[model samples]
Target chain A: QQPVQSPQAVILREGEDAVINCSSSKALYSVHWYRQKHGEAPVFLMILLKGGEQKGHDKISASFNEKKQQSSLYLTASQLSYSGTYFCGTYQGAQKLVFGQGTRLTINP
Target chain B: IAGITQAPTSQILAAGRRMTLRCTQDMRHNAMYWYRQDLGLGLRLIHYSNTAGTTGKGEVPDGYSVSRANTDDFPLTLASAVPSQTSVYFCASSDSWGRSLHFGNGTRLTVT
Candidate 1:
């Protein structure tokens, strides 16, 4: 099943913080995050497999909750380069991945 | 280093015509996938192959077909074009199971 993403769109200024959430109705084995700029391919940011694990680098981080079948991506101290469309992909059985509708993040100076 | 390459950066097809989107990966990943992205609806899986010689239907496989004859290439064919088929198609591959994917730049196809 396709995961549901919250905050269809968000606007923020430089140095602000934002959180994008994705949740599924069925059980999930893994959650993947990707960011895509207009007219470009999606670039993978990270993937979380463990229920209670959190991972990230630089100013981005993510939290996965296996029990609730939910994942949240955190963006701190946002920069102008951070403006893009964020997608959350939920890995299903047999290596199938379904992506959410996406959240458009706009960061201004 | 071309991780993944998709042919015909953009194309325009007439209805009822057959067209194929080409994809090749140099990473030698065992898994390959085809997804189509549309405005507002996001990316939808069209087809996938776990390994060479095996293919499976994805969430939105209707009207589209894919073949994985080898590890380096996965091609998607549309038997008959329809206006609704107009979208940006992306090719992606991963090492296996849940590995991170390497995506192609994508092919923008317009069906008229």
Candidate 2:
């Protein structure tokens, strides 16, 4: 099943912080975060495996809670380049990865 | 490396026509996937292959078929295209089923 993402859309000023959350009804083995610009393919951001692991890349970070069946993406001091549609993909004992509805994030100067 | 490459960046086809979207990966990943992206829907998995010569249906596999003859290629075919099949198709590859994926530029297909 597809995961659920909170805050369908968010607008933030440069240097501001934002959080995007993804929750699944089933147990997830891993959570993958991606960012897609307009008219472009999704770009891998980071992947958080089970065991309550947290990963980060530059100013972007994510946390996966196995028990909660949830993952959250954190953008610290957001930049204009961070504007894009963010999607969270979940893997749950299947060969396929299910993606969420996505959260449109706009970072303005 | 090219990572992943999708052919025919964009194409328009008539209803009931047969079309195939070609995908190739140079990363030699063990797993590959095909997904369709619509306006509101983020990305829906259509088909996937865990390794060469093996394939599986995903959440939205209807009206689509895929074959993995080798490790470097996976092609998605629409036997009879329909209007609903119009969307941006993306091919991705991963080291394993649960690993981060590397996506292709995508093929924009339109069916009228």
Candidate 3:
């Protein structure tokens, strides 16, 4: 099943922080995050594995909670470069990755 | 590395016509997938190949088909296009058991 993402849209100012949450009803073996700009392709950001783990890159980070079947993405000191649609892809035991609806984030200067 | 390339970036087709979207990956990845992106609907998987000569259906596979003749190429085909099939299609290749998915610039198709 496809994961669900919260806060369909969000607007933030520079130096602010925001969190995007994704949840699944079934157990998730892994979570992958990507960001897409308007009229462009989605770019991979990070991946979080199961068993309660976390991964970070630059000013972004994410945590995976296996028991809750949820994952959250954290963006610190938001920049205009961060403006884009964020999607969380869930991975079950299967080899395929299913994507969520996505949260559109706009960071203001 | 020219990680992935998709041909005919955008196309317009008439109903009941056939069209093919070409995708190629240089990473030598064994798994390739096809997905369609629509507003408010996110990305829907249409088909995937675990390796050469093997294919499987995904969430939304009614109007699409794919084949993995080799490790580097996976093409998506629409036999008899319909208006409802108009959307941006993405081609992706992955390794590491779905750990990360590398996507190509999508092809926007308009079926009239």
Residue-pair clashes, model 2: 0
Docking class of 1: high
lDDT of 1 by residue, B5-85 (tens): 999999999999999999999998999999999999888999999999999988899999999889999999999999999
Docking model 2 quality class: high
What DockQ number belongs to candidate 1?
A: 0.84
lDDT tens readout by residue for model 1, A1-107:
78999999999999999999999999877899999998899999999997579998689999999999899999999999999999999876676888999999999
Instruction: In angstroms, give how far residue A65 of model 3 lies from its true place.
Output: 0.5
Candidate 2's residue-wise lDDT over A42-82, tens digit each? 99998888799999899999999989999999999999999
Could you give candidate 3's per-residue lDDT for residues A32-105 as a string of tens digits?
A: 99999998889999988877888899999999998999999999999999999999998644657789999999
Candidate 1 chain B worst ten-residue window by lDDT:
B94-103
Point out the worst 10-residue segment of candidate 2 chain A by lDDT: A89-98
True contacts kept of 2: 0.91
